[model samples]
Target: MTHATELTVIHVPVSDPRVRPLLQELGDEYSRRYGKDAHGEISRYPDEEFTASHGGVLLLLLEHGEPVAGGAFRRYDATTAELKRIWTHSAHRRRGLARRVVTELEREATARGYRRIHLTTGPRQPEARGLYLATGYTPLFDTEADPETIGPLPFEKHLPATATHRATHRGKAAQP
Candidate 1:
Protein backbone atom coordinates (compact mmCIF):
# COMPACT_ATOMS: atom_id res chain seq x y z
CA MET A 1 0.00 0.00 0.00
CA THR A 2 1.17 3.45 -0.90
CA HIS A 3 0.41 6.66 0.91
CA ALA A 4 0.49 10.16 -0.52
CA THR A 5 1.80 13.09 1.45
CA GLU A 6 -0.66 15.80 2.32
CA LEU A 7 -0.10 18.74 -0.05
CA THR A 8 -0.77 22.30 1.04
CA VAL A 9 -1.28 25.14 -1.43
CA ILE A 10 -0.17 28.54 -0.21
CA HIS A 11 -0.26 31.77 -2.15
CA VAL A 12 3.13 33.43 -2.15
CA PRO A 13 3.06 37.09 -2.97
CA VAL A 14 5.25 37.55 -6.05
CA SER A 15 6.84 40.75 -4.82
CA ASP A 16 8.14 39.05 -1.72
CA PRO A 17 11.92 38.92 -2.03
CA ARG A 18 11.87 35.39 -0.62
CA VAL A 19 10.42 34.26 -3.96
CA ARG A 20 13.26 35.84 -5.98
CA PRO A 21 15.69 33.06 -5.19
CA LEU A 22 13.25 30.38 -6.23
CA LEU A 23 12.48 32.22 -9.43
CA GLN A 24 16.17 32.59 -10.14
CA GLU A 25 16.76 28.91 -9.53
CA LEU A 26 13.91 27.95 -11.81
CA GLY A 27 15.13 30.36 -14.48
CA ASP A 28 18.61 28.92 -14.38
CA GLU A 29 17.33 25.38 -14.66
CA TYR A 30 14.98 26.25 -17.45
CA SER A 31 17.74 27.94 -19.42
CA ARG A 32 20.14 25.07 -18.87
CA ARG A 33 17.59 22.49 -19.94
CA TYR A 34 16.28 24.34 -22.98
CA GLY A 35 19.37 26.28 -24.05
CA LYS A 36 17.52 29.57 -23.66
CA ASP A 37 18.31 32.72 -21.75
CA ALA A 38 15.64 33.71 -19.26
CA HIS A 39 17.41 34.74 -16.08
CA GLY A 40 17.42 38.55 -15.88
CA GLU A 41 15.05 39.30 -18.72
CA ILE A 42 11.61 37.86 -18.03
CA SER A 43 11.98 38.00 -14.30
CA ARG A 44 11.26 41.69 -14.10
CA TYR A 45 7.85 41.54 -15.72
CA PRO A 46 6.27 39.05 -13.34
CA ASP A 47 7.89 40.67 -10.36
CA GLU A 48 6.58 44.00 -11.44
CA GLU A 49 3.63 44.22 -13.81
CA PHE A 50 1.60 41.06 -13.44
CA THR A 51 2.19 40.60 -9.75
CA ALA A 52 1.70 44.25 -9.04
CA SER A 53 -1.56 45.11 -10.75
CA HIS A 54 -3.73 42.06 -11.12
CA GLY A 55 -3.15 40.27 -7.83
CA GLY A 56 -0.91 37.61 -9.29
CA VAL A 57 -1.01 34.48 -7.20
CA LEU A 58 1.85 32.03 -6.85
CA LEU A 59 0.72 28.63 -5.61
CA LEU A 60 3.46 26.78 -3.83
CA LEU A 61 3.15 23.04 -3.36
CA LEU A 62 4.64 22.13 -0.06
CA GLU A 63 5.13 18.78 1.56
CA HIS A 64 6.27 18.81 5.21
CA GLY A 65 6.76 22.58 4.91
CA GLU A 66 9.19 22.49 1.98
CA PRO A 67 8.32 24.02 -1.35
CA VAL A 68 8.63 21.28 -3.95
CA ALA A 69 6.69 22.87 -6.74
CA GLY A 70 4.98 26.12 -7.68
CA GLY A 71 2.98 27.97 -10.33
CA ALA A 72 1.71 31.50 -10.90
CA PHE A 73 -1.41 33.06 -12.36
CA ARG A 74 -2.24 36.58 -13.57
CA ARG A 75 -5.58 37.91 -14.57
CA TYR A 76 -5.73 38.83 -18.25
CA ASP A 77 -9.31 39.96 -18.32
CA ALA A 78 -12.61 39.56 -16.61
CA THR A 79 -13.09 36.16 -18.21
CA THR A 80 -9.50 35.06 -18.61
CA ALA A 81 -6.45 34.29 -16.53
CA GLU A 82 -2.91 33.40 -17.54
CA LEU A 83 -0.81 30.69 -15.96
CA LYS A 84 2.88 31.41 -15.83
CA ARG A 85 6.19 30.15 -14.48
CA ILE A 86 5.17 26.68 -13.38
CA TRP A 87 8.04 24.64 -12.06
CA THR A 88 8.70 21.56 -9.98
CA HIS A 89 12.09 20.73 -8.58
CA SER A 90 13.88 17.96 -10.48
CA ALA A 91 13.75 15.78 -7.37
CA HIS A 92 9.97 16.14 -7.32
CA ARG A 93 9.14 15.35 -10.92
CA ARG A 94 6.86 12.47 -11.97
CA ARG A 95 4.93 12.76 -8.70
CA GLY A 96 2.08 14.80 -10.25
CA LEU A 97 3.00 18.04 -8.51
CA ALA A 98 2.76 19.97 -11.76
CA ARG A 99 -0.71 18.66 -12.43
CA ARG A 100 -1.87 19.48 -8.94
CA VAL A 101 -0.48 23.01 -9.17
CA VAL A 102 -2.22 23.61 -12.45
CA THR A 103 -5.50 22.27 -11.12
CA GLU A 104 -5.25 24.41 -8.03
CA LEU A 105 -4.62 27.51 -10.13
CA GLU A 106 -7.60 26.72 -12.32
CA ARG A 107 -9.83 26.27 -9.32
CA GLU A 108 -8.58 29.51 -7.83
CA ALA A 109 -9.22 31.34 -11.07
CA THR A 110 -12.71 29.90 -11.27
CA ALA A 111 -13.42 30.94 -7.74
CA ARG A 112 -12.33 34.46 -8.71
CA GLY A 113 -14.96 34.48 -11.49
CA TYR A 114 -12.69 33.65 -14.38
CA ARG A 115 -14.26 31.38 -16.97
CA ARG A 116 -11.12 30.66 -18.96
CA ILE A 117 -7.46 30.08 -18.17
CA HIS A 118 -4.63 30.51 -20.67
CA LEU A 119 -0.97 29.56 -20.73
CA THR A 120 1.92 29.12 -23.08
CA THR A 121 4.56 26.42 -23.11
CA GLY A 122 7.62 26.21 -25.29
CA PRO A 123 7.85 23.51 -27.94
CA ARG A 124 11.08 22.25 -26.45
CA GLN A 125 9.36 21.43 -23.18
CA PRO A 126 7.56 18.25 -24.15
CA GLU A 127 6.68 17.37 -20.57
CA ALA A 128 4.95 20.71 -20.05
CA ARG A 129 3.08 20.43 -23.35
CA GLY A 130 1.95 16.94 -22.46
CA LEU A 131 0.72 18.04 -19.04
CA TYR A 132 -1.21 20.94 -20.51
CA LEU A 133 -2.86 18.72 -23.12
CA ALA A 134 -3.71 16.09 -20.56
CA THR A 135 -5.33 18.75 -18.44
CA GLY A 136 -7.61 19.76 -21.37
CA TYR A 137 -5.87 22.99 -22.49
CA THR A 138 -6.14 23.28 -26.24
CA PRO A 139 -3.68 25.04 -28.51
CA LEU A 140 -4.41 28.67 -29.30
CA PHE A 141 -4.08 30.24 -32.74
CA ASP A 142 -2.31 33.56 -32.36
CA THR A 143 1.00 33.87 -30.65
CA GLU A 144 1.70 36.68 -28.23
CA ALA A 145 5.03 38.48 -28.11
CA ASP A 146 6.82 37.06 -25.11
CA PRO A 147 10.36 37.29 -23.86
CA GLU A 148 11.49 33.93 -25.15
CA THR A 149 10.25 34.50 -28.67
CA ILE A 150 10.39 30.73 -28.62
CA GLY A 151 6.99 30.44 -30.15
CA PRO A 152 5.15 29.13 -27.16
CA LEU A 153 2.05 27.14 -27.98
CA PRO A 154 -0.79 28.91 -26.29
CA PHE A 155 -3.50 26.91 -24.52
CA GLU A 156 -6.83 27.85 -23.05
CA LYS A 157 -9.38 25.98 -21.00
CA HIS A 158 -12.92 27.24 -20.74
CA LEU A 159 -14.52 26.06 -17.55
CA PRO A 160 -18.21 25.84 -16.94
CA ALA A 161 -19.47 28.18 -14.25
CA THR A 162 -21.58 25.44 -12.69
CA ALA A 163 -18.64 23.08 -12.49
CA THR A 164 -17.56 24.45 -9.14
CA HIS A 165 -21.06 24.22 -7.72
CA ARG A 166 -21.38 20.63 -8.86
CA ALA A 167 -18.00 19.80 -7.40
CA THR A 168 -18.88 21.28 -4.03
CA HIS A 169 -22.26 19.55 -3.97
CA ARG A 170 -21.09 16.06 -4.81
CA GLY A 171 -21.69 13.43 -2.11
CA LYS A 172 -22.58 16.02 0.51
CA ALA A 173 -26.15 16.89 -0.29
CA ALA A 174 -28.70 17.42 2.48
CA GLN A 175 -29.84 14.08 3.88
CA PRO A 176 -33.09 15.32 5.34
Candidate 2:
Protein backbone atom coordinates (compact mmCIF):
# COMPACT_ATOMS: atom_id res chain seq x y z
CA MET A 1 0.00 0.00 0.00
CA THR A 2 1.18 3.51 -0.78
CA HIS A 3 1.57 5.66 2.31
CA ALA A 4 1.24 9.39 1.80
CA THR A 5 1.21 12.14 4.42
CA GLU A 6 -2.06 12.09 6.32
CA LEU A 7 -4.40 14.78 4.95
CA THR A 8 -5.99 17.34 7.21
CA VAL A 9 -9.73 17.95 6.79
CA ILE A 10 -11.36 21.02 8.27
CA HIS A 11 -14.99 22.03 8.50
CA VAL A 12 -15.82 25.31 6.79
CA PRO A 13 -18.64 27.23 8.37
CA VAL A 14 -21.49 28.02 5.98
CA SER A 15 -20.70 31.70 6.45
CA ASP A 16 -17.33 31.44 4.72
CA PRO A 17 -17.00 33.19 1.32
CA ARG A 18 -14.57 30.49 0.18
CA VAL A 19 -17.47 28.06 -0.06
CA ARG A 20 -19.21 29.97 -2.88
CA PRO A 21 -16.17 30.05 -5.12
CA LEU A 22 -15.34 26.40 -4.56
CA LEU A 23 -18.95 25.40 -5.18
CA GLN A 24 -19.09 27.54 -8.33
CA GLU A 25 -15.95 25.89 -9.62
CA LEU A 26 -17.38 22.44 -8.96
CA GLY A 27 -20.60 23.30 -10.80
CA ASP A 28 -18.88 24.93 -13.76
CA GLU A 29 -16.60 21.94 -14.20
CA TYR A 30 -19.49 19.51 -14.00
CA SER A 31 -21.52 21.42 -16.59
CA ARG A 32 -18.61 21.70 -18.98
CA ARG A 33 -17.88 18.01 -18.82
CA TYR A 34 -21.47 16.75 -18.94
CA GLY A 35 -23.06 19.26 -21.33
CA LYS A 36 -25.73 20.18 -18.81
CA ASP A 37 -26.63 23.09 -16.53
CA ALA A 38 -25.13 22.31 -13.13
CA HIS A 39 -23.94 25.72 -11.99
CA GLY A 40 -27.50 26.99 -11.71
CA GLU A 41 -28.55 24.07 -9.55
CA ILE A 42 -25.67 24.60 -7.13
CA SER A 43 -26.38 28.31 -6.82
CA ARG A 44 -29.92 27.66 -5.61
CA TYR A 45 -28.71 27.13 -2.05
CA PRO A 46 -27.14 30.14 -0.46
CA ASP A 47 -25.42 30.59 2.90
CA GLU A 48 -28.62 31.89 4.40
CA GLU A 49 -30.42 28.61 3.73
CA PHE A 50 -27.88 26.61 5.73
CA THR A 51 -27.76 29.09 8.60
CA ALA A 52 -31.50 29.65 8.97
CA SER A 53 -32.38 26.05 9.53
CA HIS A 54 -30.66 23.42 11.67
CA GLY A 55 -31.10 21.28 8.59
CA GLY A 56 -27.50 20.34 7.94
CA VAL A 57 -23.79 20.85 8.09
CA LEU A 58 -21.59 22.04 5.16
CA LEU A 59 -17.89 21.35 5.15
CA LEU A 60 -14.97 22.27 2.89
CA LEU A 61 -11.75 20.31 2.84
CA LEU A 62 -8.51 22.20 2.61
CA GLU A 63 -5.18 20.72 1.63
CA HIS A 64 -2.23 22.94 2.60
CA GLY A 65 -4.72 25.81 3.02
CA GLU A 66 -6.25 25.45 -0.46
CA PRO A 67 -9.86 24.36 -0.66
CA VAL A 68 -10.16 21.09 -2.59
CA ALA A 69 -13.49 19.49 -1.71
CA GLY A 70 -16.95 20.28 -0.31
CA GLY A 71 -19.95 18.33 0.95
CA ALA A 72 -22.99 18.72 3.19
CA PHE A 73 -25.54 16.73 5.13
CA ARG A 74 -29.18 17.77 5.50
CA ARG A 75 -31.41 16.09 7.99
CA TYR A 76 -34.28 14.20 6.37
CA ASP A 77 -35.82 13.01 9.61
CA ALA A 78 -34.83 11.80 13.05
CA THR A 79 -33.03 8.74 11.75
CA THR A 80 -32.11 9.77 8.21
CA ALA A 81 -29.77 12.31 6.62
CA GLU A 82 -29.17 13.40 3.03
CA LEU A 83 -25.70 14.10 1.72
CA LYS A 84 -25.67 17.00 -0.71
CA ARG A 85 -23.33 19.26 -2.67
CA ILE A 86 -20.47 16.73 -2.75
CA TRP A 87 -17.73 17.92 -5.06
CA THR A 88 -13.97 17.87 -5.46
CA HIS A 89 -11.86 20.16 -7.58
CA SER A 90 -10.57 18.73 -10.87
CA ALA A 91 -7.00 19.46 -9.78
CA HIS A 92 -7.59 17.37 -6.64
CA ARG A 93 -9.21 14.34 -8.20
CA ARG A 94 -7.92 10.73 -7.77
CA ARG A 95 -6.16 11.62 -4.53
CA GLY A 96 -8.86 10.07 -2.31
CA LEU A 97 -10.02 13.46 -1.03
CA ALA A 98 -13.61 12.73 -1.99
CA ARG A 99 -13.68 9.52 0.00
CA ARG A 100 -12.18 11.25 3.03
CA VAL A 101 -14.76 14.02 2.79
CA VAL A 102 -17.60 11.50 2.62
CA THR A 103 -16.22 9.58 5.58
CA GLU A 104 -15.99 12.74 7.63
CA LEU A 105 -19.53 13.68 6.69
CA GLU A 106 -20.76 10.23 7.65
CA ARG A 107 -19.07 10.58 11.02
CA GLU A 108 -20.68 13.98 11.51
CA ALA A 109 -24.09 12.63 10.58
CA THR A 110 -23.72 9.87 13.12
CA ALA A 111 -22.78 12.37 15.81
CA ARG A 112 -26.00 14.23 15.06
CA GLY A 113 -28.04 11.08 15.68
CA TYR A 114 -28.53 10.15 12.06
CA ARG A 115 -28.68 6.39 11.59
CA ARG A 116 -28.61 6.37 7.81
CA ILE A 117 -27.15 8.61 5.09
CA HIS A 118 -28.43 9.05 1.53
CA LEU A 119 -27.25 10.87 -1.56
CA THR A 120 -27.99 11.18 -5.29
CA THR A 121 -25.56 11.82 -8.12
CA GLY A 122 -25.99 12.16 -11.87
CA PRO A 123 -24.82 9.31 -14.10
CA ARG A 124 -22.19 11.53 -15.66
CA GLN A 125 -20.37 11.55 -12.34
CA PRO A 126 -18.85 8.08 -12.59
CA GLU A 127 -16.04 8.86 -10.18
CA ALA A 128 -18.55 9.87 -7.53
CA ARG A 129 -20.52 6.66 -8.02
CA GLY A 130 -17.35 4.64 -7.60
CA LEU A 131 -16.39 6.47 -4.42
CA TYR A 132 -19.81 5.96 -2.89
CA LEU A 133 -19.79 2.28 -3.72
CA ALA A 134 -16.28 1.82 -2.40
CA THR A 135 -17.24 3.56 0.81
CA GLY A 136 -20.07 1.11 1.54
CA TYR A 137 -22.99 3.00 0.04
CA THR A 138 -25.65 0.86 -1.62
CA PRO A 139 -27.93 1.78 -4.52
CA LEU A 140 -31.42 2.90 -3.64
CA PHE A 141 -34.59 3.99 -5.44
CA ASP A 142 -34.47 7.19 -7.50
CA THR A 143 -37.57 9.30 -7.01
CA GLU A 144 -36.82 12.53 -8.84
CA ALA A 145 -36.43 13.38 -12.50
CA ASP A 146 -33.00 14.91 -13.01
CA PRO A 147 -32.10 16.82 -16.16
CA GLU A 148 -28.80 14.98 -16.53
CA THR A 149 -30.22 11.64 -15.54
CA ILE A 150 -28.11 9.06 -17.28
CA GLY A 151 -30.12 7.39 -14.56
CA PRO A 152 -29.04 9.45 -11.56
CA LEU A 153 -28.06 6.95 -8.91
CA PRO A 154 -29.35 7.15 -5.35
CA PHE A 155 -27.31 5.56 -2.55
CA GLU A 156 -27.70 4.87 1.16
CA LYS A 157 -25.38 3.90 4.02
CA HIS A 158 -26.35 2.72 7.45
CA LEU A 159 -24.48 4.07 10.46
CA PRO A 160 -23.59 1.88 13.38
CA ALA A 161 -24.90 3.15 16.74
CA THR A 162 -21.41 3.52 18.17
CA ALA A 163 -20.32 5.80 15.33
CA THR A 164 -22.10 8.82 16.79
CA HIS A 165 -20.73 8.50 20.31
CA ARG A 166 -17.21 7.96 19.05
CA ALA A 167 -17.31 10.93 16.73
CA THR A 168 -18.89 13.17 19.31
CA HIS A 169 -16.19 12.40 21.82
CA ARG A 170 -13.45 12.82 19.26
CA GLY A 171 -14.84 16.17 18.17
CA LYS A 172 -15.06 17.37 21.74
CA ALA A 173 -11.46 16.43 22.37
CA ALA A 174 -10.31 18.18 19.21
CA GLN A 175 -11.89 21.44 20.29
CA PRO A 176 -9.60 23.87 22.11
Candidate 3:
Protein backbone atom coordinates (compact mmCIF):
# COMPACT_ATOMS: atom_id res chain seq x y z
CA MET A 1 0.00 0.00 0.00
CA THR A 2 1.27 3.47 -0.85
CA HIS A 3 1.76 5.68 2.15
CA ALA A 4 -0.33 8.85 2.37
CA THR A 5 2.89 10.84 2.48
CA GLU A 6 3.62 9.60 -1.03
CA LEU A 7 0.34 10.89 -2.43
CA THR A 8 0.38 13.82 -4.87
CA VAL A 9 -2.49 16.03 -5.85
CA ILE A 10 -2.87 17.80 -9.18
CA HIS A 11 -5.46 19.63 -11.21
CA VAL A 12 -6.69 17.65 -14.24
CA PRO A 13 -9.52 17.39 -16.70
CA VAL A 14 -12.66 15.73 -15.48
CA SER A 15 -12.34 13.48 -18.51
CA ASP A 16 -8.59 13.13 -18.53
CA PRO A 17 -7.29 9.59 -19.12
CA ARG A 18 -5.64 9.47 -15.71
CA VAL A 19 -8.77 10.74 -13.95
CA ARG A 20 -11.43 8.65 -15.71
CA PRO A 21 -11.37 5.82 -13.21
CA LEU A 22 -12.18 8.08 -10.30
CA LEU A 23 -15.03 9.76 -12.15
CA GLN A 24 -16.40 6.45 -13.38
CA GLU A 25 -16.34 4.96 -9.91
CA LEU A 26 -18.16 8.02 -8.61
CA GLY A 27 -20.84 7.64 -11.31
CA ASP A 28 -21.22 3.91 -10.71
CA GLU A 29 -21.64 4.35 -6.97
CA TYR A 30 -24.16 7.10 -7.53
CA SER A 31 -26.04 4.81 -9.86
CA ARG A 32 -26.18 2.10 -7.24
CA ARG A 33 -27.23 4.45 -4.47
CA TYR A 34 -29.75 6.39 -6.52
CA GLY A 35 -30.56 3.91 -9.34
CA LYS A 36 -29.52 3.24 -12.92
CA ASP A 37 -32.25 5.62 -14.10
CA ALA A 38 -30.46 8.37 -12.28
CA HIS A 39 -27.64 7.98 -14.76
CA GLY A 40 -29.22 10.75 -16.79
CA GLU A 41 -28.62 13.25 -14.05
CA ILE A 42 -25.18 11.85 -13.36
CA SER A 43 -24.12 12.32 -16.96
CA ARG A 44 -25.75 15.65 -17.65
CA TYR A 45 -23.10 17.97 -16.23
CA PRO A 46 -21.71 20.05 -19.08
CA ASP A 47 -18.08 19.52 -19.99
CA GLU A 48 -17.31 23.19 -19.41
CA GLU A 49 -18.43 22.89 -15.83
CA PHE A 50 -15.16 21.14 -15.03
CA THR A 51 -12.94 23.27 -17.19
CA ALA A 52 -10.74 25.73 -15.35
CA SER A 53 -11.02 28.24 -18.18
CA HIS A 54 -14.73 28.26 -17.57
CA GLY A 55 -14.34 29.21 -13.93
CA GLY A 56 -14.34 25.60 -12.81
CA VAL A 57 -11.71 23.18 -11.48
CA LEU A 58 -11.15 19.46 -11.08
CA LEU A 59 -8.54 17.93 -8.78
CA LEU A 60 -7.17 14.39 -8.68
CA LEU A 61 -5.29 12.75 -5.84
CA LEU A 62 -2.68 10.31 -7.04
CA GLU A 63 -1.24 7.55 -4.88
CA HIS A 64 1.81 5.81 -6.32
CA GLY A 65 1.09 8.02 -9.31
CA GLU A 66 -2.43 6.70 -9.79
CA PRO A 67 -5.62 8.65 -9.36
CA VAL A 68 -7.41 7.82 -6.10
CA ALA A 69 -9.36 10.65 -4.54
CA GLY A 70 -10.94 13.53 -6.49
CA GLY A 71 -13.39 16.42 -6.53
CA ALA A 72 -14.54 19.41 -8.60
CA PHE A 73 -16.15 22.84 -8.42
CA ARG A 74 -17.88 25.23 -10.80
CA ARG A 75 -19.08 28.79 -10.65
CA TYR A 76 -22.49 29.06 -9.06
CA ASP A 77 -22.89 32.82 -9.15
CA ALA A 78 -20.75 35.92 -9.50
CA THR A 79 -19.28 35.17 -6.08
CA THR A 80 -20.33 31.63 -5.28
CA ALA A 81 -18.88 28.30 -6.33
CA GLU A 82 -20.68 24.97 -6.39
CA LEU A 83 -18.72 21.96 -5.23
CA LYS A 84 -19.30 18.53 -6.68
CA ARG A 85 -18.02 14.99 -7.30
CA ILE A 86 -16.11 14.56 -4.04
CA TRP A 87 -14.91 10.98 -3.69
CA THR A 88 -12.14 8.92 -2.17
CA HIS A 89 -11.30 5.35 -3.08
CA SER A 90 -12.84 2.89 -0.66
CA ALA A 91 -9.42 1.56 0.23
CA HIS A 92 -8.31 5.08 1.10
CA ARG A 93 -11.17 5.99 3.41
CA ARG A 94 -10.62 7.19 6.99
CA ARG A 95 -7.34 8.67 5.83
CA GLY A 96 -8.62 12.29 5.80
CA LEU A 97 -8.28 12.58 2.01
CA ALA A 98 -11.83 13.87 1.56
CA ARG A 99 -11.28 16.61 4.09
CA ARG A 100 -8.11 17.57 2.32
CA VAL A 101 -9.97 17.69 -0.99
CA VAL A 102 -12.66 19.95 0.48
CA THR A 103 -10.06 22.24 2.01
CA GLU A 104 -8.13 22.48 -1.22
CA LEU A 105 -11.28 23.07 -3.23
CA GLU A 106 -12.19 25.95 -0.93
CA ARG A 107 -8.76 27.45 -1.31
CA GLU A 108 -8.89 27.04 -5.06
CA ALA A 109 -12.26 28.77 -5.19
CA THR A 110 -11.01 31.58 -3.03
CA ALA A 111 -8.03 32.03 -5.29
CA ARG A 112 -10.41 32.16 -8.22
CA GLY A 113 -12.28 35.04 -6.55
CA TYR A 114 -15.26 33.13 -5.21
CA ARG A 115 -16.60 34.39 -1.90
CA ARG A 116 -18.76 31.37 -1.02
CA ILE A 117 -19.39 27.75 -1.93
CA HIS A 118 -22.52 25.66 -2.15
CA LEU A 119 -22.81 21.89 -2.42
CA THR A 120 -25.21 19.02 -1.93
CA THR A 121 -24.70 15.35 -1.17
CA GLY A 122 -27.25 12.64 -1.47
CA PRO A 123 -28.76 11.58 1.81
CA ARG A 124 -27.25 8.12 1.42
CA GLN A 125 -23.83 9.68 1.69
CA PRO A 126 -23.63 10.43 5.37
CA GLU A 127 -19.86 10.44 5.23
CA ALA A 128 -19.86 13.13 2.56
CA ARG A 129 -22.30 15.17 4.61
CA GLY A 130 -20.10 14.80 7.66
CA LEU A 131 -16.99 15.80 5.77
CA TYR A 132 -18.62 19.03 4.60
CA LEU A 133 -19.98 19.81 8.07
CA ALA A 134 -16.64 19.10 9.69
CA THR A 135 -14.98 21.40 7.19
CA GLY A 136 -17.02 24.51 8.11
CA TYR A 137 -20.07 24.05 5.84
CA THR A 138 -23.43 25.16 7.17
CA PRO A 139 -26.48 23.13 6.29
CA LEU A 140 -29.03 25.02 4.19
CA PHE A 141 -31.90 23.14 5.70
CA ASP A 142 -33.37 23.73 9.11
CA THR A 143 -33.70 20.05 10.01
CA GLU A 144 -31.47 17.09 9.31
CA ALA A 145 -33.43 14.29 7.77
CA ASP A 146 -32.60 10.58 7.74
CA PRO A 147 -30.22 9.62 4.96
CA GLU A 148 -32.65 7.00 3.72
CA THR A 149 -35.56 9.40 3.61
CA ILE A 150 -34.19 12.78 2.58
CA GLY A 151 -33.45 13.87 -0.95
CA PRO A 152 -30.11 15.62 -0.64
CA LEU A 153 -28.36 17.61 2.05
CA PRO A 154 -27.41 21.07 0.92
CA PHE A 155 -24.61 23.04 2.54
CA GLU A 156 -22.76 26.27 2.08
CA LYS A 157 -19.64 28.04 3.33
CA HIS A 158 -18.33 31.53 2.88
CA LEU A 159 -14.67 31.57 2.00
CA PRO A 160 -12.40 34.12 3.64
CA ALA A 161 -11.44 36.52 0.89
CA THR A 162 -7.88 36.29 -0.36
CA ALA A 163 -5.80 38.97 -2.06
CA THR A 164 -7.21 37.84 -5.41
CA HIS A 165 -10.75 38.33 -4.17
CA ARG A 166 -10.01 41.70 -2.65
CA ALA A 167 -8.22 42.90 -5.75
CA THR A 168 -11.05 41.86 -8.02
CA HIS A 169 -13.67 43.56 -5.87
CA ARG A 170 -11.66 46.70 -5.32
CA GLY A 171 -12.84 48.01 -8.69
CA LYS A 172 -16.58 47.33 -8.25
CA ALA A 173 -17.60 50.15 -5.99
CA ALA A 174 -21.34 50.20 -5.28
CA GLN A 175 -23.36 52.62 -7.37
CA PRO A 176 -24.58 55.60 -5.32
In model 2, residue pairs whose N, Cα or C atoms come closer than 3 Å (at least 3 residues apart or on different chains), thus clashing, are none
* Residue 51 accuracy (lDDT) in model 3: 82
Expressed as tens digits, the lDDT of each residue in 43-111 for candidate 1 is 746454345246457778777877778888876765678888888877778988888889888877767
Q: Write the per-residue lDDT of candidate 3 for residues 23-50, one digit (tens) a residue.
A: 6777788888876655456557896887
TM-score of 2: 0.77
TM-score of 1: 0.77
Ranking by lDDT: 3, 1, 2
Q: Please report the candidate that would top TM-score against the real structure.
A: 3
Candidate 1, backbone clash total: 0
Worst 10 residues of 2 by lDDT: 167-176
By the TM-score metric, which is better: model 1 or model 3? 3
